[model samples]
Target: MVSWLGHIRRISLTPGANQALLRKRGFPERDLHAKTSLEMAGGSFIEGFGVAAQSSTAAEATVTLARIDGIRRGFAFEGAAMAMAIRDALPLGHRRHVSDLLEAADDHIYMIHVGVGWSFARLPRPLRRAAAAGLTDPTLTWLALDGYGFHQAFFHTDKYVKRQYIDPDPPVPTNHHPEYAPHAIDQGIGRALWFVAGADPNRAVRLIEAFAPRRHEDLFAGLGLAATYAGGAPPEELAELAERAGRHRAALAQGSVFAAEARARAHIAQPHTETAVRAITGLRVTEAAAIATQSRPSGHTVDGQVAFEVWRRRIMRRWATDDTAADGAGAPSTSRQPSTSRQPDTDGVKDGS
Candidate 1:
């Protein structure tokens, strides 16, 4: 079991504001040798660079605990109380938690923020009108994990990946994980969104709502890069995906037919045309369909005035605004990490830089 360390700072501003907030708030102004997108704790550091660590799901969170006995930083594992607190906090850093947080905090300023990014309900009337007029890219995908790491360098360690798993082709070891590297995919998406949102609420919301569930054809498809080749996705799902992509592209070309265009826009527009949603999720579309058939589920209602994605982005933007209102609460220090710590991590398990 590997020791796991997670960072959970609540920045009041988008990434850019991190520096100013940091300095104003009197946090240490450390400079990094290079600018990095995401920062890891004890779990993914190697040498002085970040290499192998990737964001993962709730289920995979235990992997750090599983492989490593009790976590040891320098020397001691966190006391029971501190460990429990960290465990409870891990999911927030791990997943792009939306629905649940928004629903729970609907009356709060954060919820209000979450709703405005892509939604007219929470949007400024002008932005809503512009969005209505089709003056925006409804669906934009920012690559995560390796994608985010391309530019900056900070605390993440590991300059080289010490281990590589040669994935088995399709129908992995179990139905639970029929794909090659399921956790890897989730980790990538989770890491990317978390990192991007840290700096840009506008882009973060779009990436989350429009492209987050990228593993789902009904979502964004750039996720295919993380696909683990679970059993092949349904052929019908594949066909439907193609149709959606074609229709989506066409809708975009047809001008500001907002709703129509979104419907046409393929939610899971995979980065790799060859990948499928099921590959990322592990479960088959049949499972989703079956669940739907079994339950006499009622469709949740929403104000149809705005696209779901738009509403979500608007909401996140508002949260960013609110965080900034009283001065950013958890913004990262835009200042650099101390130059004294530029070396890569030597541990092969945590960092691969």
Candidate 2:
């Protein structure tokens, strides 16, 4: 059977093209699937810019960035930002030295790495290693690792790459996604933190906390996902990782559970749902599945995209409870009130589409 993403083929990455496509489709809910396919197609476009910038002279890279900047915003602002980031980082990345990429600031490297999310998978499967070589810089490792993780999770059914090493074992191929395309990307980004931190879950938590303190909770959800779906890690390790990821266990768990269900839904064969949950979160299969069921899309929440917004609120609320429990006085809540209806957080940062 054809995959969901296979249907649309590649769409134009130019802002005008996307705007026109959106208008032509009338931006209807039924077209959500097609819209997502086009959004991901931008990955190839952004990666091309990165590759072009590497081969071109500095003057050419500048020209490339300028051209990218002129394009209109499409499904997400990340596409443009990624192109720019790649343009800036190409000089260092072209050297094929991880240390050079690390010399650049974390923000620049991350934008470059995460921007390559889709292209990571687009590479001829045989060339993936050559493309990902020289990624040892710990400082910038998290983002590249996350981008690779996102690539693995988004395109493959299992964790085929471990610690900059791709398992010779091939992932079961199917046109399945664990969540909406954007959310799945986030989860992949988040999951990479675990591997980037040398597979130490607690270290991953600390890394996320230090790097993106403002967006830790949302990222923690992705960490939860990688731990769950990848398996093989000691269950206790994952459990400890979840605990250190702040007091947002419930919210983190919710994201992971929903992702598992989405993966199962997309696959033609039955998934080892319970086994994966127990391995990832130390939760029984039934309990984990229950959480997934609770997060089911409703009238207010449609699909994993909107569901993430609602789940994030739960994480904030759970954080408040943790703070209250830590101190006798209740912690001041910083989160917005749980909106019965709210749009996805598409700001193009940790929570962007």
Residue-wise C-alpha lDDT for candidate 1, range 1-353, written one tens digit per residue: 32243222211111232322323322222333101211221122221011112213322322232233211110001111112222223334422222222232222211112112222222334433321221112221111111212111111211111111122331111122122123222223322332333323233234434432332221222222111111122334432332333312111111111111121221222222122322222223333223222321112212321122233233222222222211221223211111223221111111111
* CA RMSD (A), model 2: 18.8
* Residue 100 shift from truth in candidate 1, angstroms: 36
Candidate 2: TM-score? 0.37
Give candidate 2's error at residue 283 in angstroms.
Answer: 3.6
Question: What's each prediction's TM-score?
Answer: 0.19, 0.37
- Model 2, 279-337: lDDT tens digits are 34444444444445453333324343344355444433333232222121122322212
lDDT computed for candidate 1:
0.22
Q: How much lDDT does each candidate structure score? A: 0.22, 0.40
The candidate 2 region of ten consecutive residues with least summed lDDT is 69-78
